[model samples]
Target: MPRKAAQVSEADKHAAEGGAVAVDRALFLLRAFRLGDTALTLAELAQRSGLYKSTLLRLLASLEHARLVVRHADGRYGLGPEVARLHAVYAASFSLETAVMPVLRQLVQDTRESAAFHVEQGEHRLCLYRVDSPQPVRDHARAGDLLPRNRGAGGRVLRAFAGARGQLYDTIRREGVATLVGDRVPDIAGVSAPVFGPGGELRGALTLTCPASRYRPDFRTDVLRAARALTETLGGSFPFDD
Candidate 1:
């Protein structure tokens, strides 16, 4: 069967790329209910999700049954109590300890390099969390280390998203990642991407560091994906290049 043609929202694009079309589309609907939205009608959902009314209704039925949505007497819908329950569950465990460590670990596992979360600290950057490479040869930075803010991939990301104007900053803001070689310490290279907070504010930079001899340009993709994951986990929207 041919898929119907319609305008695709960024969330919808994410859903399509995620491979599980039905589940992602259902999530696409839930996400359509934004802040200050108490309720949404069928047409509103259809308009936002880019799904036909029939498909939307089916998804809504499943969502309603799962207590993820509620149908009002006015034929409108609102999020159900389960969402609050889930939020409570998430809130109880949401922290850098629970949220960031796993991503850093996986990043190290993927690239066989070091991964760290860097935050802007006045004139410098703080390594808030780090996972070292399994390889014997690597940089020796650890968590809580204060690194330079004027150079390095992580610093560039912090400066770029914070609106530092220049060609280098422009590229980082546009691509949502920064890859640099020997910007700080000699023989060190890194790729970093911005992680956003709940209000879409720049929270920190997700960085992957390796010896210049082993740095791969492809590290940018891993860094960006890790940053995007962390952004969404922190309740921020991960905006993509359109």
Candidate 2:
């Protein structure tokens, strides 16, 4: 679950940063442009950034010189070509494993259980990446193994986000997670949460599994945290939060 953020102004945060206050404030101004905003007038920028026009103009001048922001003939500001170049470079260099492995490894360490990333493959779910528990006893699943979509916590998460309807699926949808004992295999329990990629797509499910007798309900938090971290890394947002 997401914790409530303490009320803090951007100016306050910039001040709290002992060094590079100007740089932080300039970045904050850039962030004032939201999705669907093509261009912002000086007054609009001021309204959004809560900064004085003098400060903004000076920052905007520096940003324009760096090709990070552009001013139109109408005196409106828009993101510049350099931003696209940076995005292209980032997108070209990104790797799925780089974004996912660390989260799964951390989840395993935190829960002391097996962790896996599962993706829907037609009528089945594929275990794309997995980290085994340190303990000797654990489920025998591995990376590249395909499991049924009709069973298991990971499959249920995929189905729930894919519009499956039922009481259990409804609960999973509401809670942003699914937990089941003996769902996929006898005496095996699992907790799973959905991970997303860019454009709000359901990328996969991050799951933790252990013997039913040893399963702890608190593992749900670990699963949720791992899922959220991976989702953010993939440039997707998880809407469920406290």
Candidate 3:
């Protein structure tokens, strides 16, 4: 007997034909630049993006004209000034961190523990904002770091509010918080609670982390209070309070 044909959804069919090929290829070329590779030769771009040299050159011309990519004096191409301008504008307009940083710093002062705001990114979570503990020895996770989203208190809290079905998540959802000790990092304790947006959707997680030695049973009260304040500030209602 012959093997059955694979199924193709109508959405996939529409996506395959509706998008612009040139625009997609140009974006592929731009995304080929990673965190550390500041500049790339034409050959390097071709190799990394798996595009032919001729096709890449054609795409690069348009990109360079739009200032989306630029060539240096050394004949290597990198992201252009437009990207930096776009980033600056985005940072200025998106003031979530600015508004939340004061709250995070206040939490750190109150609890003397590192505080952070985390947002899920696929299978990982990104630290969007962080305030370190005042202690001489403290945990050292920084903004933009990608960490596993299935471990740590912050991850569990986000996962729970995102509707992942499990006993652990169920308990977290019910309690309005999650706690982890020696889970994501060795000898570290963390407590996290959900932050929500105006329409009550999960926005991010507010987490407090410190050495396991500093883990106090009453710390949950502070964490929960901070989460509630942040939720209200963002025009979201605190489910636990309701």
Candidate 4:
């Protein structure tokens, strides 16, 4: 008896599907670091990436040897310096800053509050650009500040709209907008929204921070509107489900 051509083709198709699944699992391991944690234990990584412990250990060993992941003295793992170098290479090749600078400045001017642009930096979020309010008593945020993704309004905004699922991400996503009543600084309030790029990928967040006393009932609406306007200007798309 001879096998049919369809049977051979189906076998080949199954092999290809299996390969793809493996690749997806590997990528999921890398993505586990993006949840704003500085480091994760093996068990935590397994739970987050949905990989079996045995599989994750093998993958982590390979990644660690390749300098993509590093194991800390405490037996936790985090992205290695090599990953930062790679990000620097990619950032140098692209110009997200050039594209969004004018919009950020406009947002600050229109809102009369401090505005900043933040992007995910390994296990944290980094403020890449910021504009201070003209008010003498205004809050100030500086560029190059690394913030925990769960901390403030800007961080929550990025986590929420980016479809992240940790406690911080879940709470913000459920709320639609992030509001901070002094999470970052005493007496300072902030609001933020996620900025998406092509293919609905999270690019960063556009945020406004001010004194808590200045926030009114309409502040959230204003921030949302500004974020939407910026999204349109940049030809960015977001998930309709969010």
Candidate 5:
């Protein structure tokens, strides 16, 4: 006989059925947009969301009516300004700075370089917390800015450590850290390492930044130390090569 499906509790079944199925499916479609994908064609959205075109039409109609999604002049669909407004509200209300800013501050004190924590936001990375170096000459980046993921050390570190595989990511997986020089800007350099959760999942990246010419041998080492410390504090372990 075929195996029977596991039984669900009465409470669980009630909770699962409490919400409208249409709402869940619509939300799934919205989540298909990742960092770097500012706009998507209808066909692309259908493929990424695993929904049929006819079904997408119905869903997109509802979403568009609510200003949750917009169709541009070029016929591509993108998130509407409503999404930005919601994100702004979320950013204003939710922050981990109280918990992690002190750690970033210490990293700055140790390396005398700007220290930051980054989190993946779709195809981009967001600087969630940052502490600038006291030196008059320092690199510039603001918290909450969405930065290109392929350009900076923190972005690459987030990708490599979070399971995107490649030659560079393979090396980062083994070493637990990443370094970059003039990758994003001609005069800025960075060292980055992964911070993980207690379950060994990626939490974010801890990065140190300084002028390309001023980056010293110890800068990378200090970033590694700070990353490890932060990971441990969050109940996670920094993986190292065997």
Candidate 6:
């Protein structure tokens, strides 16, 4: 089943109790721009993020100053040059595996599970890179593993965060994070979050995979933290608390 957006938000809010709030709201504003339009008026930006006009203006000004957003002559705003530069930095920084290898390594080291990166191409999420677990008995996923968008944890996370469909997209539009348990494989549980490119397009996803038995009561929190850390390290952002 396509997991309901309301249920996802409720669960996420309950899990984000002790994380970075400012970073969350800032990323929320960025994600809000993905709502049907590539550019937005200040009023539209404020409305989408549920922030006061004054607050949204201030945030926009800050982003503009940092070159993460660019204001048009007509008072509309779109993604800025700095985002392009950041994207270039990202592209030039590493090969696919090298780009996310640190995070994958960390995930495997910490959870003793498998970790991978997947990108959306047409109707499928293609595994582009992966890091194996140190344990001899770890679950394995290789490069080029193509799964449907609704099949597994990585797919669900990418789908929810991408906000591709209409109303379903709007509901999770401001929260750029997602999780799934057994949606893909019955006995395998995993979590994933979106990775954006310079143009704010869905470039791919970062996922941590583990056996269902290893998913403790606090597994969601652990995954969320790992996702947030990876985002920060990559100079990427998400619309939810770390």
Cα error of candidate 6 at position 56, Å: 23
TM-score of 3: 0.61
RMSD in angstroms between candidate 1 and the native structure over all alpha carbons: 4.2
Candidate 1 Cα misplacement greater than 4 A, ranges: 1-28, 36-38, 52-76, 80-82
lDDT of each: 0.89, 0.89, 0.86, 0.73, 0.82, 0.68
TM-score of 2: 0.86
Q: Write the per-residue lDDT of candidate 2 for residues 113-155, one digit (tens) a residue.
A: 9999999998999999999999998998999999999899999
Question: How do the residues 70-161 of candidate 5 rate in per-residue lDDT, one tens digit apiece?
Answer: 99999899998888899788667754666578889998888788999999999999998999999989988988889888778899998897
Q: By TM-score, how accurate is candidate 4?
A: 0.55
* lDDT at 68, model 2: 93
Worst 10 residues of 2 by lDDT: 3-12
Candidate 6 stretches with Cα past 4 Å from truth are 1-94, 164-177
Per-candidate TM vs. native?
0.78, 0.86, 0.61, 0.55, 0.59, 0.56
Q: Candidate 5 clash total?
A: 5
TM-score rank order: 2, 1, 3, 5, 6, 4
Winner of 2 and 5 under lDDT: 2
lDDT of 4 by residue, 115-194 (tens): 88888887788999888888878876689988887778888777677666787677666655677888878898988877
- Global fold similarity of model 5 (TM-score): 0.59
Give me the displacement of residue 67 in model 1, in angstroms: 6.3
In model 3, the number of clashes is 0
* Candidate 1 per-residue lDDT over residues 67-86, each given as its tens digit: 99999999999999999999
lDDT for position 129 in model 4: 88
Residue range 1-242, candidate 6, lDDT tens digits: 53343333321343346866555556677766653576888877766666656656777778888998888988899988987798688677666455577777877777777888887878998888888767776567787777778777678767776655755344444554455567777777776666654345566777777777776545555556666665655555545665
Q: How accurate is candidate 3 locally (lDDT)?
A: 0.86
Q: Is candidate 3 or candidate 6 better by TM-score?
A: 3
Reference-based lDDT, residue 220, model 4:
71
